[model samples]
Target chain A: MRVRKLIYLLWATAVFLAACGGSGKMEVTNAWGRTSPAAAANGAFYMTITNNTGQDDKLLSASAAACATVELHEMYMRENDVMGMRQVPDGYIPLPKGQTVELKVGGLHVMCINKQQEFMIGDTIPLTLQFEKAGTMEVTAEIRDSAEMPANMPGMQHGGG
Target chain B: MKQLLPLFAFLLLLLAACQSEPKYYGTLWPNPQEVADFTLTGTAGPVSLSDYAGKVVLLYFGYTFCPDVCPGTLADLGYVVRELGRDADKVQVLMITVDPERDTPEQLAEYMSHFHPSFVGLSGTEAEIAAIAAEYGVFYQRHEGTAATGYLVDHTARVFVIDQQGKYWLSFPFGMMREQMKADLQNVLRRG
Candidate 1:
């Protein structure tokens, strides 16, 4: 009986570690993509990254076959009040344990440049997100129309054009 | 049929008489104030607000990196400018880039060309941009991060109008109609 109890305790510990730190345990939610028409030539993708582990992890990089290059970017406003945006260097995004990070309009975003093919609504673009510890996870982002409001940003107006 | 023709002619005459009178479509914004004079770099060269003293001026503040709102507003302004025709010469459209760090004069020139040649693009140092934005009561904020790239900037989306005397006249919110803008310009010019 003592031996059996010890085995059960060891198994439970292994299961808990596997659930907290392993690649299969991390969670991602609210992924989306927008592809312009063939003529527009540029598109953007957005999503939220959630880290479920007790330990922190980092998002190393991302890749997609749909575009010539995939870049991470964020817009900036200076103390003097000018606004600008530039590409993120290193492409490593930090994710704290049990926290959620969002990429949306007027915020951190992923830019897909020089599209080889156009993405239309109701279609999905296959992407792979590389993490420092989570290895690589495959994701499919749904293409949305330009007029579509992001589900995360409530009270945002539409049909401004 | 012959008896009805005379009645129709009388109705047409009455309509023509009524059309000769100008219709005042309600005020744009109540209690409008005049915009102050300020100097900034333009696509052509250094230009002051006073340079457009005698013309109706449409002024909007935005940055080049804005993916949607800036371009859409400029496109609409281009359409309205074209609709004005010869009167377009009587009006000035000013686009002030809120992002001065990257929007050099050359960049401003290139970006303005994407919409209309007649439209003017302006950029200046952070201090200058902030001073003008404050004077205009525009609000903007920048998010900070260690991404080695820039952060995001959120800003107000109000377009201001200046009358012939360089005084703040009215304001158009986002998605204003071109016809409404044309009418407002005509009204301002007539008042002058």
Candidate 2:
């Protein structure tokens, strides 16, 4: 009877631990490359980051071997006549725990300036994203053709053809 | 008799010069073709190709966030529109947003004003933009990656011209000179 009671307690404790786990862990996805190599000199990168650890974490910055400079940028519309995209000097992107923040086209993106290397189809570029609390994470992004869509992540939207 | 012969020879020379002028004498490599019709939400209201009937239309497809091509092309369009003068009203310039999700009708209206007051910006659902792009034989795709931000899109860089009857007329290559575009526009207007 005591052994059975102990087993029940262990199960309850496991459930509690799972429920109390933080929701602010950072996850990155959906990176791609532009088609024209020369045009790739000033290319952009995109992905969705989800923070599940329940703690707010900021995206500090990004580094890549392919470019001399990397910047965070967001596109904004001004009046009824013009649209502009500018660099975000603040290296960090804030994410509330459990919520997903998306950096997409016509929105926020990572701009690779004066790329040192050309990205071709089937090639891969290494990207390292520094986060405030979660430290830094590395990802290898596949260079896709200009017409290929990012796999999964159906909620994402694309503009311009 | 000699004086009469000289007069006849001069008249013949004038006639020959006039006849030697060809019916058309412009570059013909960048010919126009038909583009598919698609619906999108315009700055003023919902717009379709049919709505701009009887006018020469300069159509460009781009997203607001594009740092280089979008603004550069619009600036060029602004110059062309200004050069049109009194005929500007007869020519409709349409800027279609490829990034419709973020570029709402309100956003499009604001974005259009930066280039020119007469420029019309349009956006709509994914399917709507896709259908229109397909009709024009435009190709685009979203790039996925491992950055903290989402993906970017790569698309064809071509401008389309439509005649008064709403038929595809011609295509301008990327970075087409303003003088050439103006000449093309004048020719289309004159033809109509």
Candidate 3:
């Protein structure tokens, strides 16, 4: 009877956890980065962040030991199809409650400039992300070749032109 | 009246076939622009459009500091050329820098070499660059940034295909497919 009762309690806990959401906190996933070309002084990283909390949060900054500086930037096009990439002015990206924020190519991204080490395919770079409410968290971004990435990523793999 | 009906049906079929002809990947200019010869300094010293007299030119405007857009566009072009294989030698890519103050001829060349060894980077005096840009219908401007971040340049991202005869052939808008471009380039080569 005690064993059966324990089993019931375990099942209840599993259900409770599921009801609360798989990860009821700020979480990062799909963390990936691109390898820097030989003459490239900079590299880029991308990922998706999910805010599974009831309160809003803000990503204040990011840091990588491999780079001299890490800046949040966006790639956009002006009128007449003029393309521009610039740093995010406020230096913070908002994370609304229960929403997911994606950082992808040609969109929001993390720019690692003046790299101390080259970002190569299959290598992992350690990054630290700071948030207003969620505090700081460290994540690893797996470096990938452009060919291995998606069409929207740094690699442009498409039908031959 | 019976004879006229059959003639009209045949005409309709011919029109449909014409419309079905494979479309070029890039936008075909209604009136292709005629490009004038221009000279600029590259890593290997003075270079001119006239130098590649009988070769097709893939012209683009960008800068080295551009981490995403420029590299992505160039990579797509590299793939297109690679798809051409032996025919790639008949084509040349010229990347003109919009940020003259920062992108010297040497810097531009070094940056471009990362994309494709055959790619060449061009830089010239402010007036010289402007004249060439104007002729190509390219517009560009700079945006300020932090001291550490330097600045950003916004410029036209279209790819211009200049035929071997030095005439503007087509404009490939940003985000065009490589396969479509390859098909069009193949047709261009076949004509020659």
Candidate closest to the true structure, highest TM-score: 3
Clashes of each: 7, 37, 7
Each prediction's DockQ?
A: 0.06, 0.02, 0.36
- Model 1: per-residue lDDT, tens digit, B1-192? 999999999999999987552442322444567777889997567889898889888888876655444654666677777888878888888878776776677766666665677778898888988999898778766655333324545676667778887777476555445566667667767777
lDDT of each residue in A31-68, candidate 1, tens digit only: 78653444333356778898876678988777889877
**Evaluation by lDDT, superior candidate among 2 and 3:** 3
- Off-target runs (Cα >4 Å) in candidate 3 are A1-18, A21-25, A53-55, A117-123, A143-161, B1-21
Candidate 2 lDDT, B22-126, residue by residue in tens: 322222324455555666787567788777878888888876545444654566667777898988888888877777765677766666665678778888888
Candidate 3: lDDT of B106?
79
TM-score, cand. 3: 0.83
For candidate 2, give the DockQ.
0.02
Choose the strongest candidate by DockQ: 3
Q: How well is each residue in A45-102 modelled by candidate 2, as lDDT tens digits?
A: 7778888765778888888998777777765443321334566656567878778888
Best by lDDT: 3
- Cα distance off (Å), candidate 3, residue B91: 1.7
